[model samples]
Target: MSSVAARLAAWWHSGSRWPAVLLDAALIAVAGADLWFNRMPGNWWDDAVLVAGVLALAARRRFPLAVFIATLPMPLLMGQSAASLIALFTVACSTRNRWLLSACALVYAALTIAPWWGGSDILSESAWPVWGVYSLAPAGAAVLLGQLVQTKAELSRRLEEISEVREHEQALATQKVLAQERAHLAREMHDVVSHQVSLIAVRAGALQVSTEEAASKEAADTIRTLAARTLDELRYMVSVLRAGGGAGNGLAPQPTLDQLGELVDNAGMGAELEKGPLPELSPPVQRAIYRTVQEALTNARKHAPGAAVGVQLTQDDGAVLAEVVNTAPKRPAVPLPSAKHGLIGLKQRAELLGGAFEAGPTNTGGWRVALRVPLKSMS
Candidate 1:
């Protein structure tokens, strides 16, 4: 019975009122048929009360108490109407007000027993003792069934909400794990790779000063310069990983637009920098641009040694653009070990800033990497 009521409630809530209307009409038709077939002496007052009670059942969901009250007098005139049962059931299921529910149940029970108490010839006098019990049975059953349906609906809704919250929390946990992994990688690069690279640069610097051969001296100088630039890049990466955490003592401020000239000079390859009046950029954007150029130079040095690279930086209509293009290698390309994540990292950075990145082979058999980042201020 509870399940049937739940199905009916679900149908009603689905905005298809025609089914419920049809059911009510069918119930009224059946009640009229019962009266006609039984040859019950039907007067205009009983007919009127029956029709009115059935009509009031239509608005039971919106005004349960009112509908229930409207049907109360019908039972006294017309023996028990299906309309009254439906209205009572609706009131029990829709309202959580305990006082109102109890009052409605009591009223319905009293009405159900009224005819029996008034010595109607419908039942034998011996049945009068169980009148209250019989009258309250159906009403109690309806209320219990309605309460069950309501409890089930409430539980289903809460479970859905809990499932959604759990999914959201799971996504957040995954992101936190990824962030921690990035931080650990950054720490490893700083503590291990940077130290070795710096030592190499120190040794190369000593060799450059002490060596007399022009070729050896040039090679040593190149190594030392490249090492220093690598250290700078590692510092920037560490800062990014730490995400607002201080970079510790003796760390220089992150590179910006002003350092483009020095970056090209240190590349040891003939690289050109093209730019216009740069827009005021936040720290993250500046760092992204700087890193884009730095990674491009590093790739060129590794894959196309002696290539003439051009680095261009400009700002246009609320965006900062950086492009790096390197010509085909002038010397034999050196086969260097590659992690191949530089472009991937740059792509992630640009997207994170609500921008775009693209890298591919140029039409002239060269390579080009470009990044466009919005210049919106970060709050």
Candidate 2:
């Protein structure tokens, strides 16, 4: 019952005034016929006054203040009819213009009192007290109605703002859910692809070492190298998914400190390296350090071909640090193949492991990649 009533109230408030206009027109027609045909006590001027007041209501919403002002002459010209009082009340209830409502009230009040000084039909000798009562009543009613309109308008605006905020929040929540799903799908793909490639690489390497025929041995070596490269790509994909979800336990066999030398040599860059003992580290921290170096070397080769590159690793009291710095390319080269994703992925990996990653150009005109990972205490 409460919901039904609320809906009805909303419909009433938002509904156009055209239907109300038609009803007012019907009333004016009846009032005119009575005054003209039945020789009613009121003059035709009073009938004309009623018609004007009824027509003013149609424009109440569009120009509410003007509607109030248009009805001002009704009380003075026709000497205060009941219909005139209702029109004034309608204007106040429909409009939030307080100044216009207040002005209308003052003018109507003065006109009501005017009949007391002059001979007007509105105030009879026997009903002088009734005149003041009718005049003051609708004036007070108009003020209350205007306040109600103002309050309703403010409530409508607040509800609209709240609806917009709720819609925005819902959109953000949906995007987060979709991102998590994509990351989960990516994690599954990584496991299947990397495990298969690693197995193939291990088998190919064993075959190359065991083969007696030179031709067969060379073919096996080629297969092994291809498998290893494919495994590296799979590792990168897994790292991206893990970084996406803020979940680092996505896979096993992630390249670690042990693989740093192989990573540089395998890239065929003939890079020089310096090393330090690797402290035992968390799986995620080890992976982050590996990926940072791998991406640095890959970028160096692709952007600065034939330039000398250097990698340094150090383990101190609290952290494991790695830096890969490459010499600047002598010629203008095609800019590095930028996924624009690798560096961002690198940053996520470091942050997820409670470390920091920094990459940019060095002052001497070369690119540098540096990162620090927290180490498990040896003790």
Candidate 3:
């Protein structure tokens, strides 16, 4: 029973033809009943006219004016009918022409009242106001009801359109935010993670080719295995980010100052670290310093192989300063593929933490990369 009610409600709300057809059926039944009870005795023609008016309502929605004209004969003979009233109401619901509506109401009223006006002393038998109410009341009510339904339907349609537009705009805003996050992640994975992994691969290749000691060769194999595993994990992470799906898997731990000593030691090149007592800093500041050092070490390896690189860290006046300086290579450097965005990425990262990054060639044909981070943001 509930399901049947739901379907009926849906049919009523939607633009289904069933509701209109049912309405016409009901009006026809009412008109037929009235004719059956009040038919003129021995008047076959009058009965036929009433039946024709009742049948005409089936086409009322498509041809409201024509159906009303067909039903007008019933009002002239019987003084009133459900068929004529239904036809007039349909016309009002389907159109908005004021002149046309006024004319239809006037004609229907005159026809409905014509039967009463035919007898002698009719004016004396019925008061003018009584006939006026009888003629106009039902017609006026039908027209008003039809106009209200039409207006309500129009308002409903507009609300649906507005709702759809808002949903579309929300989807666009969500996509825009996701796109920005994906771009930032792409830069981090490429600039920092990939660079470190490539260094591991390079060092492993060098050790495998140059070393003949069994244990050293095994260590090189272990490093390559570890590098490959790290790459596989990163590949999965990158795919998840691109597809915009995945539970947030906490990424591998971010780099920090504690890792700097190990980083410098395993750089596969000669480098020195000089620093005083390190100040406690926010995670972002620590990570920035670590990446700056990492990127500088990578550049020294690529452009100045066999060069001695120096890294110094100092804190003064509520700011941490980090600098990497390398001497001219003693031997020709190995060629490496470069995207050239390393310095630019470091600059962007520092600025995000209210810091600055600098990199340039030195006067002695060496290179220097430096970073300065203000501690005001952490405070």
Clashing pairs in 3: none
lDDT of candidates 1 onward, in order: 0.75, 0.68, 0.80
Predicted model with the maximum TM-score: 1
User: lDDT at 186 for candidate 3?
Assistant: 68
User: Candidate 2 vs candidate 3: which has greater TM-score?
Assistant: 3
Q: What TM-score fits each model?
A: 0.54, 0.43, 0.51
Top lDDT model: 3
Better of 1 and 3 by TM-score: 1
Q: List ranges where model 3 is wrong by over 4 Å.
A: 1-22, 37-43, 116-130, 158-184, 205-218, 221-240, 243-379
TM-score-based ranking: 1, 3, 2
Candidate 2 Cα misplacement greater than 4 A, ranges: 1-47, 79-97, 118-133, 180-379
How many clashes in each structure?
0, 0, 0
How far residue 347's Cα lies from its native spot in candidate 3, in Å, is 30
List of clashing residue pairs for candidate 2: none
